[model samples]
Target: MTTYPPNIAKLFEPRPRLKYLEHIDIAPKERSTPAVSGLSGYLAQLKSYDSEIQYTPTEGPIQKQQRERRERQRVQQAKVASDLARWNPSEDPQIQGDPFKTLFVGRLDYEVTELELQKKFAGFGPIERVRIVRDQRGKSRGYAFLIFNSEYDCRNAYKESNGMKINERELVTDIERGRTIKHWQPRRLGGGLGGRHYTKTRVWGGRTNTFGGPSGPRSVHQTRTAPRFGTRPAYSLRLGPTERRPYERQASNERPERDPRYGGKYGVYEKYKDVKTEAPYKYESRDSRDFRDRDARVPERREREPARDKKEDRTTRFDRSMY
Candidate 1:
């Protein structure tokens, strides 16, 4: 049996008085106690009141754990988003090639076949594959995608064949980055007004205006004509020759043989003959002849009475013997 100190026994007391033992352990004259004893006593007390002592984890430690979990989840979500953004069939394990080496195109001619396009573009570089999208009805959708073996080859093909002509049509090409390449075919020649190419118009002679002259429907008819000649007759009237009386001739001969006034070589009648002949007096004759004929018919008369008696007699007799 081990013997214990009297103070140790007091420690087990139900109610011990320790007011007089103040600083007893540290006093110079006090006996030093083994540290093991104090340790054993403390262990006993802990066991006796173990249920009464409660422990809780610190807020800082719990918060640190939750932050670490959140960081891990965030990193995983970012990875999933990045993978979705750059998803591509060429990047799949089954497909073997540089995924970045490809191009998409639109605005393609419907009449152009995929083989024809591939053949045309194969001259530029090595083409892995050419795909022309088609609808459910097996008709082309007018678009395509082109895959090249090398990035440099794809770039060269893009540069050389971007605006390359195919059947009088130009094509457009766009490089596909991380996303799936969309097939784009060139639009038809008559797709829209802006994409159409204009052709030069032609004019024919006689069909169009010739040298700025009139040109249209014309009629066939005569524009000119010609000219026509002949013979006809004339008209006249006549007065025939007639006999003269002796008395009229004698009366013409005796009419003023001479004038006593100066030598009557020519009478006033002779003087005015030219004027009177030009303007002869008109008269009606019994035989419908001129006045000359009627005057010639009259007989010449010589008066037998005295000059005074002739003068007194208003009427005078004519002797035909005077002719």
Candidate 2:
């Protein structure tokens, strides 16, 4: 241990001092009522008053929580019921509203550029950006998106540019609500020759497509019953190989058979094959005859000789004697 001066040792030594000020109480004080009317109390009360108006609900906290939960559940249930009631399975999903400040510019010509779109939309308001949606092949999808600095400008552009013709193409402008819906589409089963409007089954190329319900694209192997023809009673036997059932078969026994003698079905042409028809006038011959000859000159006839050159001498003697 090293020795030091008494005053120096005092500087190194731990000193004892009074823990309280003169005549001041240091022990735990007696309990006293809170000053509710004090200025600080008033300030705290004001803070609480703001909180009460904002969030300190009048009802019990548990009951308020339960009521809010019940309200949320009821709203959800109602939304689900409404969605169920309005649901159409056949319709494609559609986007309803616009959330972003983007406008959809449709019916754009393939030659139209982003600069042209920006220039056209800039007339309404300042455009933030212009994007013509393209595919992997880098060709425009016939639509473009235009983001504006404000929603007002977007709305203005959508309203003003709608149906406006550019480069001989009319524009279809609206807010970009994402996906579009086709309003008119063919029914699932019947598309063209055999559509759903047909009340019966229609078969083509050994495949059957039913028109009444949503059973679409059924093959011949999947069918349970025979398909019926359009509106006719079912026949016992099909008339032709291509024909299906349910058609009125024509009278097979009543029709006459083709004649086998005249080379079967072509018998009517047999008479006209080699037969030569005569003209209206009869053919004239080379020999001269009255009505048969076609020559213009008339034929001369021989004159009859006076009767009786042979018996002339005897007749003359008898006449002379009688005189």
Give the best candidate by TM-score. 1
* Model 2 alpha-carbon drift over 4 Å, by segment: 1-98, 179-323
**TM-score of every candidate relative to the true structure:** 0.27, 0.27
At residue 49, candidate 2 shows an lDDT of 83
In order of listing, the candidates' clash counts read 15, 1
| lDDT, candidates in the order shown | 0.55, 0.61
Model 1 TM-score, 2 decimals: 0.27
Candidate 1 lDDT, tens digit per residue, 1-323?
A: 13667878767668766676556356677658666544665887888686787777667978999999999989877876665555555555534445578766657888889899888888767888887878888788776778887788888877777787788878877675334435322223211222322232223322432242234432121111111101111111011111222332336556665655433456455655545434343324433222223344322321223223334332322232223
Clashes of 1: 15
RMSD from true fold, candidate 1: 56.6
| Residue-wise C-alpha lDDT for candidate 2, range 1-323, written one tens digit per residue | 14987878777886789598564554457546666664775788898888788765489989989999999989877876665556452443332223357787877999899998888778999887788878899998777778888889888888888888778998888665423243322122112121224456555445565654455675333333334554442321112124354345557686576566666445667756556333333325422123323332323332223234444586664574356
